[model samples]
Target: MKARVTISLKNGVLDPQGKAIAHALHGLGFDNVGEVRQGKVIELDLGDIAAADAPAEVEKMCTQLLANTVIENYEFELLD
Candidate 1:
């Protein structure tokens, strides 16, 4: 099974990268661009975990390392 972890800054948290990207977009003529929030996607290939348990296993990984739960929120999807 394959698992994908999507991690992003929690609401009300500052996002410097997102701010830079938004600024660049406006400079490049993307005037209509609004708030930009940046996030990361981590794709994992699980060999031992069963499909039904992939999400739980991946959640553990996120809590351990993939995401900084203090300032970020995470969600995961399992794929065959």
Candidate 2:
């Protein structure tokens, strides 16, 4: 099984990197883009431990080590 985790800043949070990218895009003549937010994606191969509780376990992992819940929000998808 494969798990994909995505971590992103909350809506009200400021994202400097994303803003920079947006500005660069606008400079390159890409219009109609309102805002951009940067985030991270982590892919994990949990070989053989693909159970119904996997999503919760992964969420726990994010809360415990992968993400700073105080500023970022995390979500995950499990694939077989």
Candidate 3:
């Protein structure tokens, strides 16, 4: 099965990297873009894992190491 974990900053949290990206975009003439929030996608090829178990397993990995739960939130989805 294939899976994906998306990690993002919680609401009201300041994101300097996101700001930088927005700035760069505006400089490149993308002036209509609004606030840009940044996040990350982690793809996994969980070979041989059951479809029912992949989401939970990837979520555990997110809680343990992939994300900082204090200021970040994560969600996982099974792709196949």
- Give per-residue CA lDDT, model 2, range 1-80, as digits (tens): 88999999988899999999999999999998879999999998878885887888898899999899888999999989
For candidate 1, write residues 38-68 as lDDT tens digits: 9999989898777777777788899999999
Give the per-residue lDDT digits (tens) of candidate 3, residues 24-77.
999999999889999999998899998777777887898899999999999888
lDDT of 1 at 2: 84
Q: What is the lDDT of residue 56 in candidate 2?
A: 82
Q: Stretches of candidate 1 above 4 Å error?
A: none
Where is the poorest 10-residue window by lDDT in model 2? 46-55
lDDT by candidate, in order shown: 0.91, 0.91, 0.90
Name model 2 segments beyond 4 Å from true. none
- List the candidate 3 regions with Cα displacement exceeding 4 Å: none
> Relative to the unseen true structure, what is the C-alpha lDDT of residue 72 in candidate 1, on a scale of 0 to 100?
99
TM-score pick, better of 1 and 3: 1
lDDT of 3 at 1: 87
Q: What is the lDDT of candidate 3?
A: 0.90
**Model 3: pairs clashing at backbone N, Cα or C within 3 Å:** none
- Residue 3, model 3, lDDT: 80
Model 3 lDDT-worst window of ten: 50-59
